[model samples]
Target chain A: MNDMARLQKQRLALYGWMLVAPALALMSLFAFYPAIATLWHSLFTRGTTRRPSVFAGIENYNDLFADPTFWIVVWNNLIYAGITIPVSIIFALAMALWANAHIPARSFVRSAYFTPTILPMIAAANLWLFFYTPDLGVIDQITGFFGASPTNWLGQPETALASVIMVTIWKEAGFFMIFYLAALQTIPPDLREAARIEGAGRWTYTRRVLLPLLMPTTIFVFVNAMINSVKLIDHLFILTKGGPNNASKLILYWIWEMAFAYFDSPHAAAMTILVLLTLGLVAVIQFRLVEKRTHYR
Target chain B: MNTALASRPAKRALPDFDKVLDALGAWVLAIVWISPLLFATWAALQPSGTALGLDFSNPLTFENFTYVWNAVPWAGYFANTVVLVTLILAGQLVLCTLAGFAFARFEFRGRDTIFILVLLQLFILPEVLIVENYAIVSKLGLFDTALGIGLPYMASAFGIFLLRQAFKSVPVELEEAARIEGCSWMGVLWKVYVPAAKPVYLAYALVSIATHWNNFLWPLIVTNSPDTRPLTVGLSLFGAPETGVDISVISAATIMTVAPLLIAFLIFQRQFIQAFLRAGIR
Candidate 1:
């Protein structure tokens, strides 16, 4: 190329770097650096005022593996994810279909479904807490009319996790509905008409055409919900605090407790690394699904 | 004509039953979903005696709201939340716009690699690295400040990704046309690209504001003082079981905490839903 062209090219590259520099710097400080630092810090023993920090390779991870609390937290989180993800997704699809249909009070129904998404999880927990309170609570009041005794929903091991799960499903289903509603809107109306012409009933049209077409959106929402299961433990603070023998403890909540409450940084760091690895696997799967989705389009 | 009328009645009967059933199911679920907020609102407005009662004869009162409002430092929490959300949104717009523009228009070495690295931020969210981030904030002497809570999220990967897609869709001819009129690269961006990406910016702003406003854990960790604690953290503290507050009072506080966003959502219901739809679809 000519000298002028080469100089312009160089200038463009310089401008590009300049534009990207601030974000890169910030990400390094918070995301990239902290991530590496977490792994590094996880390799050392927790230092107090007397003892200097020393290397203890894999000891933190071993300690976490040995802890029964950690194992319980892992199981709890798995159940949390397993239930909340699928149940909420199904509810979202049903909500989207209903709201998109020619139903009475369509907008009100949609609003009712989506309102929970806008409320902070803390507030949602508070609302549910009112409902779960022993005798004076709404659930108990209704059950009382039917002659059933008041139950301690959030106070027992058998019921605490389920109560937490109920709150999560209520909070999330509406949020996911928006994505399905968007996807549903994009689908051409003629497809439904064509299905009808082909002697397909409403159920067949939904199953054979609608659901298949919504696969990409389902995958997207699924991955998002999976990520949320790890991050969304705010309600636990108000509703259960992972109590009643830690029946409702989630992984992220445990990490916070270990690091902040107990002041055990190394163990928290180890758990953080484990969480990161799981998220990395999720990211890989998400990219693959997205690529396949693009190809389908 | 008689045969046509007969077929029409039969055709309408089956679908009518189905439609009625579908609508019934939808309304039932909607009522179940919305009952919590409705119940909360009821408890907030009713006297403590009738807060959880099924009695319809009890009169509604604002005493709970008045009591809770006086007891809590709600004004300070609101101020802190407004400041934090605004700071995060402003920083995110500028940083994400710049990075997105470069990724969209520039031809630099390792550009593709850098884009991938940025995408990785989606997975390595700041919430996951709270331990290290807390130490970093303390080291920087930003502990207990709103800036510390907002800084990590300013360079948001989601915002950048959305803006990049939006910018990439702008026709290259528009940029070339601006350039022919003696526009510099930055001038071209200002005059041509940013304006074209207005909708994406709006969508991102709405999502970011709602997300940060409802954020609890990080703010709960970083801020020890009421001066910096956002609404979510403040609400949690006020409603904690040990606080010895009545259930009605706590419900009042809960409603007060979510009222702003909830009211905004109700007012701009279409825009709020559309914003999430637009932002999530990508």
Candidate 2:
């Protein structure tokens, strides 16, 4: 190439660097640096009045491994995910199917289904907070008509996590419904005509053909819901605080308490690493699923 | 499939009994789904338990709202949230636009590699790395401030990715013509690229505002005082166990915090829904 062309190429490269610099610098500070720093910081013991700081080498992990609360948090999170993920997906698919169907006042129904998604989880928690209140609560009042005893929803060990799970499912299903709605809209009309001509029942057609067609959206929403299961503990702060002997605590909330409330940064760091690893696995699956979906298209 | 059938109403010849049952079931489920929000509005308008107990004749009152307004510094929370979201959106637009432009058009050494690294931020979200991020924020002397809450999210990976895709689709001829008109690199970007991406900017801004406005946890940890607490944190604090949990008062507070966004969504329901579809599709 000519000298002028080479100089212009160099100038373009310089411009590229300059353009990306601010975003790269900001991301490094918050996203990238912290990811590395979490691993690095997990090695040192938290400083205290007696001890400055010392490398503990996996001692934090050892402590966490032995801690009953850690086990409980992990177990609770598994149950939370197991229940919310599938149930919400089912509910989302149902919502999408209904909203997309030829129903009277369908937009109103769609609006109702989609509103919870836009509201903050904290607000949703607070709204449900009163429903679980003991005597004066709404649930008890309704059950009182049947002469049934009122149960402590968020206060009890058994019911607290279940209550939170319900809220998560409620918040998520509508959000996922939108994607399913979009996906539902994309399925060709000729398929419906072919199914009708074949004399397939509505249920049979939906189960066999529709579900397979929606596999991509189902996978996408499932991954998103899985990530949200970990990310969404905002309601816990208002509703339970992972309380009633820590029955409702998730791993993320536990990490928060260990770091901020208890000042156990190393322990929190170790927990953070574990969460990142889990997310990484899920992300890899999501990446491959997306790749496959693109290939199919 | 059902939606397609519905659109062609002429072909929806038969309203079978099974179809009627399905539609009824859907309405029932949708009611149950949104009952909490519906309850919040009703309870906020009337006394709390009465709404839940199906006593509609109870005189509607604004006493709960007045009590909640008096109980908390909602004005401060509102202002903080406004400032925080506005600041974050502005920073994201400028930063993401620059980075997206480079990723889309400019070719530099390690350009593809760096772009891949940036995309990885989607998986390793800042939400997950709160432990170290909090420490870093406090260390940078940005602790307990709006900047601290908003700074971590300013360079959004999602925004960069979306804008990159948007910019890439812009016709190269537009850029060349601008260049021929003696436009500088920044000038070409300002005039040619950004205007073509207006829809993207609007979509991203809406998502950002909604997300940041409702954001909790980080703000809960970072901001110790009401001065920096956004509406989410502030509402949670007001409704926390330490304060006596009056259902009416808390509902009123909840309604107040969510009302602005709720109203916006109501007015721009189609836009918000389409924006979310756009976000998801991307």
The CA lDDT of each predicted structure is: 0.92, 0.89
Ten residues in a row with the worst lDDT in model 1 chain B?
Answer: B1-10
CA lDDT, candidate 1, residue B279: 85
- Across A1-297, the per-residue lDDT of candidate 2 in tens digits comes to 699999999999999999999999999999889999999888888888998979989998899999999899999999999999999999999999889888889998998889988899899999887678776677888888789998988989989999999999999899899999998988887887788778876788999999999999999899999999899999999999998899899988998898889988899999999998999899899889999989987
Q: What share of the true interface contacts does each candidate keep?
A: 0.88, 0.84
lDDT tens digits, residues B58-172, model 2? 9988988988777788898999999999999999999999999999999999999999889888889677788888888889998999999999999899999999999999999
- Candidate 1, residues B17-104, lDDT tens digits: the string is 8878989999999999999988888888888756777566888899998987788788999999999999999999999999999999
True contacts kept of 2: 0.84
Worst 10 residues of 2 chain A by lDDT: A129-138
TM-score of 1: 0.97
lDDT of residue A263 for candidate 1: 99
